[model samples]
Target: MQIVFYARVSTDEQTAAHQAKQAKAAGFEIDVVVADEGVSGVSTALADRPQGRRLFDMLRRDDVLVVRWVDRLGRNYADVTETIREFMRRGVIVKTVINGMVFDGATTDPMLMAVRDALILFMAATAQAQTEATKEAQKAGIEHAKGREDAYLGRKPSYTRKQFDSVVDAFNRGEAVAAIHKATGISRGTIYRIRDNRGQAEAALARWAA
Candidate 1:
């Protein structure tokens, strides 16, 4: 029963190594990592992605599949729920790094199964909602930039909102600057800036990722 870490790096700012580190920090000893880079989870199905397709073929009964969250499996509600259920049916244990959530099909209790399924549905819906909100925010930011007298929107932040959040999370977890830099692919200078003035850094990120 090997543990596999699956990463969907949808954006330039996202990195698979960062996620793998998170999984390790959460006490998971991963044996393999499959990553699909430059893939849009919001638009692409897991099985349709190159690495995602490989993932389906590679997983075996009793194997463990680890993801950053339900969204990494599928961004939308239907896809997320279906992907999870399919894995469960195949005897693959699904786990998330975010909350250390485990979805295994080793239960016979009807009520417990119901609760688990409901949680999956809720998490899937929440993932979809977050995706929609990000899209809307990006649209708003672009429109706002276009309407501005100056074509420049400040420095056009070097990092995305997700990267900024990752740094903050690492900081809160007591990770050092170098580790955060390695995990996020962000520069030491930027991390220091964030450390010194988190409020200002967040304001800048909000404006850019608006």
Candidate 2:
């Protein structure tokens, strides 16, 4: 009956601690806090996240996995649906702090199951759409960057490269995702991107290492 709280942020400036505090305020006795920083939810898959992957690995039957929202679980339709279903099948109860959404496997009513599944599918699809829109926006920004390459002095990096490395090291060592977010202020989306684009992020980090 362990309760696990998961939070994520997109940059080092945002802390998951706030989310954890919210979950605690909601009456969840959190046994662990998992946070992923610099993980962009828009492009990163839940299954590919370091802490996300660890969640699947560490979660046992009857454990409660609490997140701020379904979006926190993922932003993609297929990924979100699949992840939730898998956890439900494994006897994990997925709960959300914002809306008190609960998805469990114990329901025997076929209609209830169908409705639950459908809701999950719809929400996941919406999350995916949101992510896609974000990607397009980033693409536009990059294009803008290219146009100004000559006159533009690049903005300072959001974080020192070493900090990114440290985050990754902590992730690899199985540090809780919530802890990482609290310490680094990185968003959940950014954490996912970090896990998905380790090589690229590492390269960026190297370029910004100072």
Candidate 3:
């Protein structure tokens, strides 16, 4: 049985090599590497990915599959849960680098199976919830940016959309200007500008959101 590592990179800055290095650092005896670069389909099935399909073909009963996290298996809760369950059913052990979790189907105990299944459900649900939250935050920032862009203000916002969102969120949370600056790595002057003129700042963020 092979010990395979799967790396899925969503951004250009993320690298399979780096993930492999991390896995090695974690003391996983990796025998093979299967990677899908720039693959971030929120609803895509693991079987559908170009390299993801290779997993079904390569993995066998008792083989160990390692990933950075449960989220890397799939994006949505259903997909993640189903994929892990399927692998477990096939006697393939699923291991995660983050916490050294091992999900194996070698046992015949009913109670243990019940507990494992419940844990899988909880983790998958958490991953999906996080994905939804990120999309909402991005949407808010984008809308705010568009508002500023249509207004055609000459003084453009210096901060990126992410930075603008951070500043806005910090102020709305009643954080001090100095605290916002420190947390978001933005200048005090810019944080004050974002705080003092909320609408204008959002408009700038919305424009950059596009």
Best by lDDT: 1
TM-score, one value per model: 0.74, 0.64, 0.73
TM-score of 1: 0.74
Single out the weakest 10-residue window by summed lDDT for candidate 3: 165-174
- How would you encode candidate 2's per-residue C-alpha lDDT over 1-210 as one tens digit per residue? 789988877655456897798788889889999988778665687778888888988899999999977878877777789889999999999998765778998878999999888878877786676556434534544554554535534444465544564466446435576767776777766776766765555444433333
Q: Indicate which candidate wins on TM-score.
A: 1
RMSD of model 1, in Å? 5.0
Please, what is the whole-model Cα lDDT of each candidate in the order they appear? 0.81, 0.72, 0.77
Q: What is candidate 3's lDDT per residue for 59-152, written digit by digit as tens? A: 9999999997787787689899989989988989999877677888886799988888888898788777766655665566576555353565
lDDT (10s digit) by residue, model 1, range 1-210? 889999998767778998898899999999999999988888899999999998889898999999978878877789999999999999999999876788988767999898999989988898787666555544555555554554455776787777875676556445789988987898999999977876666555555653
> Which sections of candidate 3 miss by over 4 Å?
150-207
Candidate 1 vs 2: which has more lDDT:
1
lDDT, model 1: 0.81
TM-score of 3: 0.73
Query: Which window of ten consecutive residues has the lowest lDDT sum in model 2?
Result: 201-210
Arrange candidates by lDDT, highest first: which order?
A: 1, 3, 2
